[model samples]
Structures are given as structure tokens and as C-alpha cells.
Target: MGLPKPLRLKHWQDFQATYQQGKRYRGMYLLLRVLPDPRLNQSRFGIAVSQKVSKKAVVRNRIKRQLRAILLSQRPNLAGGFNVIVVVLPSAVLCKYEHFLRELEQLFKQAGIMNHGH
Candidate 1:
């Protein structure tokens, strides 16, 4: 199963706030924002894909799907109490799923959400 819809950030303010004030890391396919969750015991995520990244809707949706799958697969390792926003870059369209997962794992390590040795 995937993350429930309620766990996703649906408000524009949420994404804007995260982008403006959260700690972030840049990767080959996406930029990741790590922010403390205001809601206790809950984690939220938001995904952004600007028009510049893709002209076709299908491309954007594919990237979002790939990213969501990566996030869901790593949910067990992710710190349980944070809000994470992933901003998809144009380069993401060219990346393979494994590469995306690797970049995400590296970002999680850098954010201290995952251990390097793990």
C-alpha cells in the first residue's frame, strides 16, 4: 500500500512554507525538503512539478508516481515525525527508478533520517 491521502500536504501554504523555511537537499532528480511536522505522530509529504519541468501531463504524472513509490518503499526507514516535500526537477524525466531511489536514500542519509551504515 501507499501513503494515505490524508498524509499528503494538500494546501498551497504547506508547500510554500516548507520551501521557504525547511532544510533541503538537491539531488539528481529532485530537491527534498525536510521539515518538522506540526502534527504529532504524523508525517506529511508534498510533491511539486512545475510547468518548466514537463510540458505534458503524462510525464509529470509518471515522475510523481515514481517518486511516490520510492517514498512508500522507504517509509519504514523514514523518520516518523516529519513533513517531507519533494520538488521534481526537469532532469527527473530522464532518470531511472533505481537512480531515483538511490538519490532519495542519499538524501535521507544526509538529513539524518537514515543511517549511513544501514
Candidate 2:
């Protein structure tokens, strides 16, 4: 129904590797870490929403959904051969979707995962 789940990075090891190798960006609502994937043909993503950010399950799920939607919508423009992790910040709950999207786009472009015109 969507971009499918194969593009998501589900393993803890994958998230660890990205943190070890990637470049990070801090936005108003999230921190993004992006690393070049060794495999070179697809993009993978992970999201980290901690209890420190939101103790409630509903809030955390909402954050995840917002992040997932942003990623899926921009998948076609994302650079292949990379792994990304988006760590939710405590301030994320206050951000609107448009602002979140803008922040994400800026970070991705800065990370060289998206072109200037995209």
C-alpha cells in the first residue's frame, strides 16, 4: 500500500552502525543521522523515539507515524545506498507537519541525500 517496509532499517545493529559512521543534524524536533550504505543500491531508515522524549505510548506512536510519512513521501528523491536514523527530540510533539517536513528536507539536503532542486 505504501513504499513497503523493505526500505526500513529494523535491526539494532543497523542503527548502531549509522550512529558510528553517519553525519548528524539537529532540527527543531528531531536529530537525523545519515550514513552511506555499503550495499549501494537501496536506502534504509530507522527511527528512535525514547522514553525521555515522551513517556506515553500514544505520543511516541504519533511521532513515529509522522516520521514515517515524511520518509515515505520523500523516498523517491532520497539518495540510494544510505542508512538513516531519525531520533525524535522532546520538542517534536509541538511541531507541525509542515515545519517538520521543512526541517527534514533541509537536513537531508545538507547530508547530500537530496539534491538542491528536489
Candidate 3:
């Protein structure tokens, strides 16, 4: 399952706000930005993959899908009321899905965004 609408960061303001005020987690494949939002009371997320990462749209979408899959699988572990965005780096294309998931999970853990004792 994918992230629901209420759990998605779509508006430009939301993205901008998260970018400006959020804490950052740098990983091998993605850079995560997270900002706490009290109004929502639930977490929202956005995925960013620039053309610079891949000239082909197919490759970009594939990367996005991989990321969304990782996030969806770990949804229960994430805390609520936060806006998170994952920015893909060019190196992401070369990595295996399991490797990417592991790196992302580690970063989320380090950021304290994921609930403990999972």
C-alpha cells in the first residue's frame, strides 16, 4: 500500500516549510528532510527525484517506486505529525533495493523519526 492522501505532502507551502525548518538525514541514496507539524497530527511525505539523477523518466519513476515501497513497508514505525521528504541522489540508481531500504531505515532510526522497540 502507498501513503494515503492525508499522509502525503503535496502543496508547495508544505514542501517549502519542511525544507526550511526540517531536520536533515543524509544517506547513501537519499537525503531525508523532516519537519514536525502539529496541525496535521499525522505524518506526510514527499519524494523528490531530479532529472539530474536520471535523464530517463522511466528510471526516475522506478527510483521513486522503490523509495515509496520502502516507506510504505515501514509506515508503522514512523512517528505521526511530521512532514518528510526523500530526495534521491544519482547514486541511488546503482544500489539494490535491499541496500536502499537498509540505509533509509538506518537514517530514520538515527533521526529518531521511527518508533523504537519495533
Candidate 4:
């Protein structure tokens, strides 16, 4: 699943704004930043796999795909109107897909973004 333009953070400034103003959730595999944006009334997502995480473009793309899939699946469960960014750790390149899913889920929960059966 891919995020549409309006539902994705497409600029460096957007990512930087989230990093600056958002709440952070750190995990073993990844980091999450969430910035509230009531104007959208829906959540938008961004995936950032730094070159520090992996030198190869292929590896970075693979990690981005995995993270996008996880976010897309959880999108409906997340709260509205927020910009969420997933930053992969260098260790994440060696981690399994399930690890990414698990860590992201927990991060969302900690960020109070998930519905959590409410």
C-alpha cells in the first residue's frame, strides 16, 4: 500500500517540523515523531530511512516499503489529523518485517495515536 500525495509528507521541511514540534517515541528498531495537524482532519505519514541506516538505495527502499505497508494497515486505527514520521535505525536493516510492524505498533500506542479498542 502506498500513501497518496495529500496523505504523505513530501517535503524535508515537513519532516523537520515534525521532528521539532512532534512528540517522540523511541524504539529498538525505529523512531516515531507525531505532530498534530488539525487542519487535515486525517493522518498523513512519512518514512525516513537515512543513509546512515543503510548505504544501499535498495536496502533503504525496502525498509521504506515495509514501513509504508505497516502504516497503511494501521491508518484506520490511528487518530485523525497528524503528521507521523517513521525513522529507521541502522540496526533495522538487519531486522525482520515483523520487528518493524511490532515496533511501529508499540510506538503508535505510546504516542496515543492508535484507537486501542476505544
Estimate candidate 4's alpha-carbon lDDT, on a 0 to 1 scale.
0.87
Candidate 2 per-residue lDDT, tens place, 1-118, comes to: 3336778888888888899988988888889999887686778888889998888999888778887899889988888989989888888877778887999998898888894569
Model 3: per-residue Cα lDDT over 1-118, one tens digit each = 5677887899999999899999999987889998888887778889999998999999998888888888888888988888999989888877788987998888888778889886
Error of 2 at 63 (Å): 0.9
Clash statistics: count for each candidate: 0, 0, 1, 0
Better of 2 and 4 by TM-score: 4
Write down the RMSD of all candidates, one decimal each. Answer: 1.9, 1.6, 1.2, 1.3
Per-model TM-score versus the true fold: 0.88, 0.91, 0.93, 0.93
| Cα TM-score of candidate 3 | 0.93
Highest-TM-score candidate: 3
Between candidates 1 and 4, the TM-score winner: 4
Ranked by lDDT, the better of candidates 1 and 2 is: 2
**Runs off by more than 4 Å, candidate 3:** none
- Pick by lDDT: 1 or 3, better one: 3
- Residue-level lDDT of model 1, residues 7-44, one tens digit each, is 68888888887888889899878888988875736567
Query: Which residue pairs of candidate 1 clash?
Result: none
TM for candidate 4 is: 0.93
